[model samples]
Target: MSHATRTRPARTSASARRTHTELLSVYLNDHLAGATAGTDRARYLARSCRGTDLGPTLEAIAGEIAKDRRSLTDLLRRLHIPARRYKVYAGWTAEKLGRLKANGRLVRRSPLSTVVELEMLRAGVTGKIACWEALRQLAESDERLDPAVLDDLLHRGHRQLHALEELHREQTAVTFHASGPQAPTPASRGTGAR
Candidate 1:
């Protein structure tokens, strides 16, 4: 048979293609869940920190996160992948549930609460960085992705992590090491004096 007339080597098997599609769907769904949760956390942090030293930074992060979420949606659309709405809903629900967690205080915002939240936000940003890196790796094989955009997102994620870490450090120090009111002595307590 002539070289041009010969049949090309077979591509991936139908079953293998289906498996790949399934795995890709699962991967995208998982990333969407995390992105949704990160969006929730960012908004919460921005609102909760309003009028405080961390407010502006949180607001900026929140805005960036919102944009990132939109970008993820766009990417899914570009790839013709339907997002799992259920997972998105669940992620938002989980974020709401997180807000109800009890701190040591009954009515006041706990310093520890901010500390833990900063850590969680930082971790989420870290995860975002990973997602961007993974997508970047696929850009060579997948024409739907843009490496430049992924690079920009990866840089933003790192910046977000740095800002969160700085805030976390400052808050941790203030919460744990700053001078504070000491407990009343026995004599003072007995006398009913603060």
Candidate 2:
């Protein structure tokens, strides 16, 4: 290949770049809103978890999640991606709704509740890893984002996923195996009902 081609950045028309940037900004913001809700979940878990083993760990994870959300907003500012308030509100509302799901019990806490929430947190962390990876790809071409920062965010996402997965396993085992190994029926499973 010619040196010019090898060294030259991939080219797109100005209009195309603008359109792509606009789309990406919206997409990132949507995911940012989701991440915001994930932080809420972490905070809720930290507060609601009464178990001696999971409580402190969940609190620490909640702190980390808050930091991650702050880092994301900072990145958005650096990129000139305007924050959409409505999306943020929507995310918060969704998290609140998630809390109302039935978890085998009517008025009291259920072990299954923790298991389900942990799984949701794990899913969010998975998405966070993807978000960081997407931005890391742009870091190669976009000057506003630091590759090192994205790398750190990705690393933190991995750590969050690891912690969440551990909690998920422990919670599921505790929730379903209270007696012994048994087949989970529809009612016994996470159907959000008794």
Q: What is the TM-score of each candidate against the true structure?
A: 0.85, 0.85
Give the Cα-based TM-score of candidate 2 against the true structure: 0.85
Off by over 4 Å in 2: 1-12, 180-194
Tens-digit lDDT track for model 2 on 56-173? 8899999999999999899999999998999999999999999999889999988788888999998898988898999999999999999999999999889989988988888777
* Local accuracy by lDDT, each model: 0.86, 0.88
In order, what is each prediction's RMSD in angstroms? Answer: 6.7, 7.0
lDDT of 1 by residue, 31-56 (tens): 89988998998898789889999899
Regions of candidate 1 where Cα sits further than 4 Å from its true position: 1-12, 178-194
Compute the lDDT for candidate 1: 0.86
Judged by whole-model lDDT over C-alpha atoms, candidate 2 comes out at 0.88
Q: For this target, which candidate reaches the highest lDDT against the unseen true structure?
A: 2
